[model samples]
Target: MLAVQHCNNSALHVDEGFSNQTQQVLGVAPVRCRENLNTTTNPTAAGLSMTLGIVSNIIALIILAKAYARLRKRSKATFLLFASSLVATDLAGHVIPGALVLRLYISGTAGGLCNQSDATCHFLGGSMVFFGLCPLFLGCVMAAERCMGVTRPLLHARMVCTAHTKIVLVMIWLLALSVALLPFFHLGTYIYQFPGTWCFINVLDNTSITDVIFVLLFSGLGLAALAVALVCNTISGVTLVIARLRKKKCHRRSAKSHDIEMVAQLVGIMVTSCICWSPLLIFGLMSVIRSYSGSMGDDLETYRTLMVMGVRLATWNQILDPWVYILLRRAVLKKIYRITTGRSDLKGSTFRRWEISSFQNSMKSVINRN
Candidate 1:
């Protein structure tokens, strides 16, 4: 009789376990796991997107390497090092997480992994945060470095070098990794996001003080970095303009032109990062606020849809970032200008020399003033 009772209890527990899994699969589980139940229904789209990202970043890396080879003897080598690191990080961002998602889709277990493997889910979630935030941080760093170079040439020359820049890059990666690892310490949670192809920090609802803090930290740092880049870039740009107005010579214009080119790239980085990352960071904060205020009443689905859209938008930053360096340089812009205006003579024209020389003189004036 006891044996029969034990068998019945075992059967009952098995049924309960199956029921819980079913609920989770159907999006009827707790709010934490209630993302859209559709799991990589369109593998083609996932595959194509990852392929394009991987290819573009690879091309960008190649271009950067060639440029670095040419610029190794130039003063801009430090800046190129930072740019190369950012591209490498973005490449890893695409490869590591992209490979995992592709594996899940290929194995026909896209949605089931989160339910079956906690470690896999956590790593995916952390990658999402780490990659998302690293570019923004690096953008700020690049902008600040350029700003100092333009506005305080003496101080910049004394302090910024390739070795120091490398140390800074390592520190930036460590900082991002530290934040990504917080969830493992019970400071936050990572769960499968909608369509069940990726995992990220849970932004749908608040469950603990640590979770709220983690979300705030991620979004807050991103927004703050953008803000700093904006200010530094603005000041650097204004200083350049002022220097240009103060100087009238054409000698050393190449140097000034190079400075302008670097600043221009920084501006491009700032704009791309703002457009790509703002929606997601803003949505994260809004979601938290709405959860706290009980205003998510009937718009939970809308919020989820927006979150997915935001994530998709953020991914574009990685792809767009490389192009900023590839296309915004002096050589490329001059070629494009010549093509559009049918002025091939612009390349070897006297005006081009004056333009370069004037830029160099203006830069000198600014440094002297500093």
Candidate 2:
């Protein structure tokens, strides 16, 4: 994410100075208005991604509910908690919002998805603004928590609790909303840009101040949050490795094979985070700068295609999250598989008591499903 933000800044600074007066580029013009300031994307692609996201989110929700039920009264894994949360918010911010935009475009809603009312736009925009930073901040929090767990394991157990976690969550919500909502407050334009097929905070008002605020909220603050998370996470992962080596030197039992497996699962989760999110960090600033500076060409169309692809990548996190958690914790997979198969696995469980009881108990509710 740091790399992406740096790359975006490098591209923008090289092409156009920060002066807004010299930058009079147009925004997404999906109408017949040949005056300028327009762009377009395939509603088909948007719709398809939305469909996939919705399906994925639904699956994740089911798998998670069963897992939670099965794990009740057990020592729940923190990464599992983080993964569950991140997936939920990813759907809210990226996938579902994108779906709404595409729905409006297909329905030919003239003023975006606000029912052509400023009030609705404000509600929608504020909603989008409020939840917008969720995935980014959630990722960071997950990473930070993971790092602290590895670096300061004893502290992790003592410092964090349901109440403390809730407080932290409240703070994250307040902070993200405070930063993202700043634009709506200052611009007094909540649903700033609809552009027919996609929606974003419009930065192309008469003053172009909207553009700056949009850039700052989505790019500036989003990048900062991601950077902090990535640094903490990277440190945590490295420390895990170091700790393992020291444990080996001391001839103390390192992380058990199962524990190592769990870390591997979390690593996959983190890698997907980078894949889905980094592109958005890089392209968001570049796209805005290009829009501001009139630097886009036919090749720029290709870039826009990639940008949309990147945004979709973030959306995929919602769907992929279920699998990540299931892979980390077997109970989730057991429940999902039982739900699909309609019967518990009778194939032959030669496993030990703890594993068998956990899987069977998890599958009990699942097997009873329709």
Q: Using lDDT as the measure, which candidate wins?
A: 1
Q: Write the per-residue lDDT of candidate 1 for residues 202-265, one digit (tens) a residue.
A: 7665445666788899999999999999999999899988776566364323336667888889
Candidate 2 wrong stretches, greater than 4 Å: 1-47, 69-77, 94-99, 102-106, 110-131, 187-195, 203-207, 247-249, 256-262, 290-307, 328-370
Candidate 2 similarity to native, TM-score: 0.65
lDDT of 2 at 78: 56
Clashing pairs in 1: 250-357, 252-360, 253-356, 253-357, 253-360, 254-356, 256-359, 256-360
User: What is the number of backbone collisions in each predicted candidate, taken in the order shown?
Assistant: 8, 9
Per-residue lDDT of 124-231 in model 2, one digit per residue for the tens?
556555554776677678777767766776798678665666677778778877765665566534433423233345433222556555665676666776677668
What are the runs in model 1 whose C-alpha is more than 4 Å off? 1-35, 113-117, 248-255, 347-351, 354-370
Please report, in order, the local distance difference test score of every candidate based on alpha carbons.
Answer: 0.76, 0.55
The TM-score of predicted model 1 comes to 0.84
For candidate 2, what is the lDDT? 0.55
| Per-residue error (Å), model 2, residue 370 | 40
